[model samples]
Target: TQPIIVTTTTAPQQGGSGSGQQGGNGSGSGQQGGAQDLKEVLNSKVSKWGDANGDGGVDMGDVVLIMQSLANPNKYSLKDAGAFNADVSEAGGGITANDALTIQKYLLGSVTKLPESYAENIKTVTAPATTTRATTTTAKPTTTTKATTKAPSQASGQKFSVKNGQNQFKGDSDGYSYEIWLDQTGGSGSMTLGNGGTFDTEWSAQVSKGNFLARRGMDFDRTKKATDVGKITLDYAADYSASSQGNSRLCVYGWMTDPLVEYYIIEDWVNWCPQPQGGSKTVTIDGAQYEIFTLDHYGPTILDNQSRNFKQYFSVRKSKRTSGSITVSDHFKAWADAGWNIGNLTEVALNVEGWESSGKANVSKLTIDVSGGGQGGNTQQGGNTQQGGNTQQGGAQVQAGKKLCAISFDDGASAQSTSDPGYRIINALAENNMTATFFNVGSWIKTEQQIKYEYQKGMEVANHTQTHPHLGQLGSGQVRSEWEQCNSKLKSIIGAEPSHLMRLPYLESNGTVQSALYDVPLISCAIDTKDWNNASTNDIVNTIKQAAQNGSLEGAIVLCHENYATTAAAMEQVLPWLAQNGYQNVNISDMAKAHGKTLAGGQVHTRA
Candidate 1:
């Protein structure tokens, strides 16, 4: 059991030692005291699943109680078994901020159940009788420590103050050491490196609220082949103010000496860097998703007069998790499979990089498990050797000799149809195992949940103007307003901005419209179903069938309206025909990628 300290202001009553004392009623029955004792015992047992106050429910109130205890350990207490219940981590250690985060994740629906121990203990506990108590109030505890600590000192010119022992490099503060001497922005924090021998190192840090507290962990030798070094695992706990507007990250860093490239696997919140080359692909490892990116560095210098020519690879986690273990080798394998020549490993490090943020983090363990011997194979040289393979396919490349087609529905959630055309269209596409793009009108969105359902079902929800206006005639301001309103609505509904693909009303676009769009790509279809004109279902089907036979449908973006019942009827046949004809029905984004193109800002795209 963890230690529990209880503080009281009033002195204990005389003649009562761990026994019942006479109250204002002047009565102290032995049976009444026994019942009270039983209630306390039951409360202690019931509190073991994040119910810190023993109120029989794990909610925000319990979270607040735990925070209070952390803030003032002496004045406030977990009280009996509250500490055990609060240990939500799998480690089953004492209560920490990670336990609070686990409870938060449970409340947020990210996690469906508490830790295993909490469930196991709750199943065996028995309930106690309830009792009513007289009203009483206690004074608030005095503030001994501020909720936020002051930023650390930053007069030290180094990124982090280093204390170099015989075989150790320890950091005295959280700082940054850039290859180029950029203007310094001052901030303060502290970190430590332990077991800092020549080959092994451990790092931990507590960053008091500040701005741009970027620091690197100690570097480990990376002279051996990657296969020989089986895996590197990082066990860590991190917490930051959710209200903070800046970015904070904990990531593993690898540097290759030959190509002078750096690879980073990062878990970040808010903070970001420019990826001029853009993201390549997303890979899932250990059930966590990561977005990979590569970029060439164009800096003035590389660590004080070193070469500035280098490349960078970043694998950023899709979601922020406060506590977990990362298998570094799996990420490397993903990049290697994607044609990234990782080259010979030279230095490996874990870093806590922060920018304009206030937070704290702890790394409990860092272990590198090595297996196998160096096979004595010649090291693959050059920066571009690993840049082959199926990297393009991992993003959106279509197989050679295979044609790509995109099916798109416009003006979604229309009120004209007898049934939900969006639902029916999605069902047809899903049955065929295909994905399409939907251009939604903001006003037509009856409920955000409907849009969420479409997005969740693997359909791309894009912007069609707020009221489906003709951008060719609308002024620049109106065009911006129309695009912004629709994008904002989609973001609010689906928790992300719509894919930067928009279609002009009636396909009416001009230079003015194009300039107004700025960065958003204009999506024009290769084949027009003309279902908006109330074409017969057979006519719609025949148009697509003829296009496919004539080879016009190959690498084509087909346009149909979700508001029309004929379009939905047409897709019931068109999707199966495309699948049968050796065509892969993909979204516009995928189709663009298949053709070695990006569906990004300022580009007008049409099907081949």
Candidate 2:
């Protein structure tokens, strides 16, 4: 570097003394530098060293100020500083021109393109050292625990239950758990937990109608043949009497062709008239004794036509069964008549469209007088001729032994009247907490919400044929279609077929509709009130008042449509009037049982 500077100071053309000359201290170099004017110009254009604000010159504290701003950006105002002075702003934070120069210098071997590469020489050197140190470390282990749980098994049996689990459904473990009691023995028995009581969970003591059931997991197999079961020795005399007049008790005993959940019925006659009063039969299964005490399935539904809720009560005095014969002994026979088959309904009731498979009946404090319509008595607009009454010129049929009664209402569920007087009548009924049988049209039950609302409100949706036609009048195919469609629709909308009762469109029929009821019960009315013809309120009330008195018409099944607002209004007068009288309301289901009933044409899984 020094040699080059010396050469520039002593150029011979400048006429100044050369560096090698005696006066070459270079003070006289100014004379020779006069020709090189470019040198001065070049010095003037160089970048300022410390002018951090980029005004092209270095200041006293540029570097220090840049460092201070980098440490605390808030201390320096971006607007007052240029890129050179603002470290964050100029370097884009920490980037700078020097960094780029360093990278470029590394890529070029000598930082300035190998120093023009005229001539270059490189040297190598090395250094080494040896050292050692050691230490030990320990690690911790992990721990974990796991838990296991077991699920309980369900009990088996075909059973019936109630929501409350108290009255009307005591001594039965219906809801506290899931179970179905099948092939149940009719005789008395008891169960006591002994030793550890072979069950997975704690056992709940159980009893039913004085009979006991062993808990699940017990060694006594689930499918026990009760054909040889002992008798349910009941003290009949304690609660039963023979010579009782109007308020006699009747014990019902029957063996199911198949396992059953409950005895169901269709016609109001079956429900109202315990007409099938008294008789007994025995079946010998494997020489074991099985007895069925059935009343005549005829009477009120047959020749008499008098609809009466007649139930005969019997107490079990003794029962004994051998492997060869299961014998049942009871005395529910009270009335003068007795028959095992209630025979075909037509043979029994003379004018019955046909036989109604099963039915109901009840004996209570207040006697009831049912019109063709259940409690739906009072009004229907027939014509100007019969404006004051709900009666037609039909023969007396239904007979009620009890003094109290309630009528069932139909047509209230039709789309046309769901909210009119039909609706108001229901509201009125609700005001009194009254209940009635409402045979619904299949078409109306199109949604789940509708069915749920009706059920929650305590209104029963029974089958009124797919359409409102006299079922007996349709062809066999049409009849089958009617029941099938209604059943399917009801199942979809209501979750199950209430399948309790069915009414013929006109108490009119042929053999076709009859056969379709293998799983549905038949509900034949006790009387023909012909409200569809528009019987008047006064006529309805008066006819019902007489029905309560007349023998054949005592338990008459009343029929009424909801097309007119008059029916709902009329019920107000009739129902309160019945309550004021000796009449009491009875569920249609209970009424049908008196007739030995069940769903006729089909069966369904009653359990989930």
lDDT of 2 at 85: 27
In model 2, what lDDT does residue 270 have? 16
Clashing pairs in 1: 48-85, 159-175, 159-176, 212-356, 247-271, 339-386, 519-601
* Structural similarity to truth (TM-score) of each candidate: 0.37, 0.35
Compose the digit string of candidate 1's lDDT tens values, residues 1-608: 01112222222211111111111011122133344453343344333476654434465445544554564332233442455466564323345556666776775678777652332222212211011111011111111121012243331222121111101112222221111000123333433322211111112222343333223332222223443345654444544332245555666765653345677887755456435376478899879888887888764221221235777878888886656777776876787788877654533445555555545544443333322332111121111111101011112223355566787888875643335776788778777766677888898777676677667666777888899876767898898889889988887887754666786666665545655664566776656777877689999999888978976677677888886677778888788887788876766655554443333233244452
**All candidates' lDDT scores?**
0.51, 0.30
RMSD in Å for all candidates = 27.1, 45.4
Candidate 1 residue runs with Cα over 4 Å from true position: 1-402, 415-419
Evaluate model 2: give its lDDT: 0.30
Cα error of candidate 1 at position 10, Å: 98
| Candidate 2 lDDT tens digits, 519-593 | 344454544345556667777667666766653232334666554555666777777766556554433443322
